[model samples]
Target: MKELSLYLMSLLYITAGVNHFVMPKVYLRIMPPYVPFHKTMVFLSGIAEVLLGVGLLFTLTREWAAWGIILLLIVIFPANVEQLKNKKARGKLPLWVVILRLPLQLVLIWWAWLYT
Candidate 1:
């Protein structure tokens, strides 16, 4: 089950990372205005996500990868909060979906911490 979770997590992040490049505009919408260079940040984060996801595949870097993922989750949290608080930032997402996403971040953090 642990291995399965890790595999799924890796795939989740990799797919998300790819989506960052494939659909950059989708992410740009949710970015907090205070953050500068939304496009660059999106691209860089995509690389980070892909690297961290790939790193998880190796025993030597699994813990580090997990830590990196946790850190990424923490770093992006403010944006999540912004998205929930500013309905316009969330675009078409229903209020309930935005609300539910806040707690989901915690779940993702916990899931990543399991590797650490």
Candidate 2:
């Protein structure tokens, strides 16, 4: 089950990373105004997610990958918060739902920490 979960988590991140390229507009919408080079950040984050997800597959890199994932989550958090600030980005989602989503990042961070 642990291995299965690891694979599932990897798949989740890998799919999400691929989505960065596939539907970048969705990501671009939530970017904080102060964050420079929005496209670059999105592209690099996609790369990081892909690499870290792949890294999780190996014993040698799993823990480091997990830590990297934790860091990545932290780094991207502002974009998540941007939803609260930018209602247009919120895109009809309820304010409560957007607020609730903030904790989801911590949950993801915790999930990554499990592998570490």
Candidate 3:
């Protein structure tokens, strides 16, 4: 179970990281207004995600990578809040979906903690 979870988490982060570059505009839209250099931040975060995800694949780095992912999730949470707040303005994504996402973040955090 531990190994399976690690693999899934790694895949999750890697896929998300790839998406940041493949669909940068989607991430850009969800970023809070106060944030600066949206494009650069998006790209850097993508890199971080990929690197951390790769790190997870190694036994030696798995703990550190898990912690990195947890920190990354916390750091980016405000964007999720901002996205939820402006879901209507951003697009027609359902209110329930946004509402559910908040809890999902906590679940992701807990899942990351397991590796620590």
Q: What is the C-alpha RMSD of each candidate to the true structure, in Å?
A: 0.9, 1.1, 1.2
lDDT of 1: 0.91
What lDDT would each prediction earn against the true structure?
Answer: 0.91, 0.92, 0.90
Stretches of candidate 1 off by over 4 Å are: none
lDDT of 2 by residue, 1-116 (tens): 88998998899888889899998988899999999999988989998999999999999999999999999999999998998889999987899999998999998899889999
- Residue 103 deviation, candidate 1, in Å? 1.1
User: Against the correct fold, how does model 2 do in TM-score?
Assistant: 0.94
| Off by more than 4 A, model 2 | none
| Ten residues in sequence with the least summed lDDT for candidate 2 | 8-17
Give the C-alpha lDDT of model 3.
0.90
In candidate 3, which residue ranges exceed 4 Å CA deviation? Answer: 88-90
Candidate 1 vs candidate 3: which has greater lDDT? 1
Ordered from best to worst lDDT, the candidate numbers read: 2, 1, 3
Instruction: Score residue 87 of candidate 3 by CA lDDT.
Output: 59
User: Which of the two candidates, 1 or 3, achieves a greater TM-score against the reference?
Assistant: 1
Candidate 3 residue pairs in backbone clash: none
lDDT of 2: 0.92
